[model samples]
Target: MKNFFKIIIIAAFGVMLYPLFDSFSGNGQLNDLASFYAQKENVEKVNSANLVTAVVVTYRGLDTLGEVTILFLTAAIIAFFLTKQSEVRTLRRNSEIFQTAARLLIPVIIMVGVYIFINGHLSPGGGFQGGAVIASAVILMLLAFPNMPFNSKLFGLIESTSGLVFVGIAFLGVLIGTGFLDNAILPLGTFGELLSAGTIPIIYSFVGLKVGAELSNIISGLQSVQADN
Candidate 1:
């Protein structure tokens, strides 16, 4: 029967994914690269409290650039998918308590998200982590106030402008620093200060803003579609 074949197919696919489950083993090419970046020479020059962040934002900045590009491309693809459909009903709720709670929490969440992005050079959190946190805050607002419409155009503009600004900063680094994406142009500042790492924090802040906006937009769109359905 068709049901039997479907079950078999799903079981096969699940078996295929089983190999992906593995315990952590740290020895690898990436570990070697990390060790190199953590060396005293690079760490002192970058003046970052978190060596991994320094490597990602400075030494391997081009890779970071590519990663950002991929995210932008993904957002574009998602937008394209949404554009094909019309008549989506935006999600809304009718709970006063939820609305009040969201309003109270939004500011606090935004502050924490900004702090995470700003302190990335000295901590475990970074632009992506902070961005997700902010996006969740936006989602909270959506859940609380279903009737309140979001300005999708404004969010899109902010996301696009922030991305372009990040590109411009990297281009400027080429002219002032060693090369394209080189971050030696700005003063590194103190090792553990918020303003340290030259322009890393600034760049991460932009990334966080862009990512948060885009992700919030995606959630908005998806919820709209779900409501329509």
Candidate 2:
């Protein structure tokens, strides 16, 4: 069955890639709407060097919020179904190398994830990417220390607080700025710098924290259920 699925996926991928065989023709230029976004006026409004950050956090921030909500719902549903274990279970230990690696690398991995989100307004990454990276660090830790004490409530609190702060910032934009999720609720800091893009970095930071904690909650919930089984 797995082989059949793989074959089907390979064939579908091949069909999708067939279009690439055709000659790529057309002048390299931004489309009308994209060109409008690149205009000095619009760029200055968001004041983010990363165009994707401008679009996601400011222009279509409501959509970003919705996406984050969906993830929260998903984690909630998973936690609801996965009953927590009342007693700790002894699990097999990992190899020495994995244990050492987890100890040494978890902090560095987490720092990298934080960096990705913190500088999201100036670079190619954002909250989601950073959050996923953080989740991966948690995954590695879980694998290394299977019997480690997991703190689901703390993670939940962080997730909830971050989400609330994110919403509060959005409402501030509505009350003070021209529209919902406007980046201008605060001063648009100097461009091409760490503190630029007004509330963008703040929003993205909270988003990363929420997403990371939510994902960790789901993972720990799954682990608990597995222990029960």
Q: Per-prediction TM-score, please? A: 0.82, 0.87
Error of 1 at 219 (Å): 1.0
Per-residue accuracy of model 2 over 26-65 as CA lDDT, tens digit each: 7599999889889999999899999998989888899999
lDDT of each: 0.82, 0.91
**TM-score, predicted candidate 1 vs. hidden true structure:** 0.82
Give the per-residue lDDT digits (tens) of candidate 1, residues 72-152: 787777777765345645555567786788889999999999899888889998888899999999998877776677888
Question: Which candidate has the highest TM-score of all?
Answer: 2
For candidate 2, the lDDT comes to 0.91
Superposed model 2: Cα runs more than 4 Å off: 1-27, 86-88, 227-229
Worst 10 residues of 2 by lDDT: 18-27
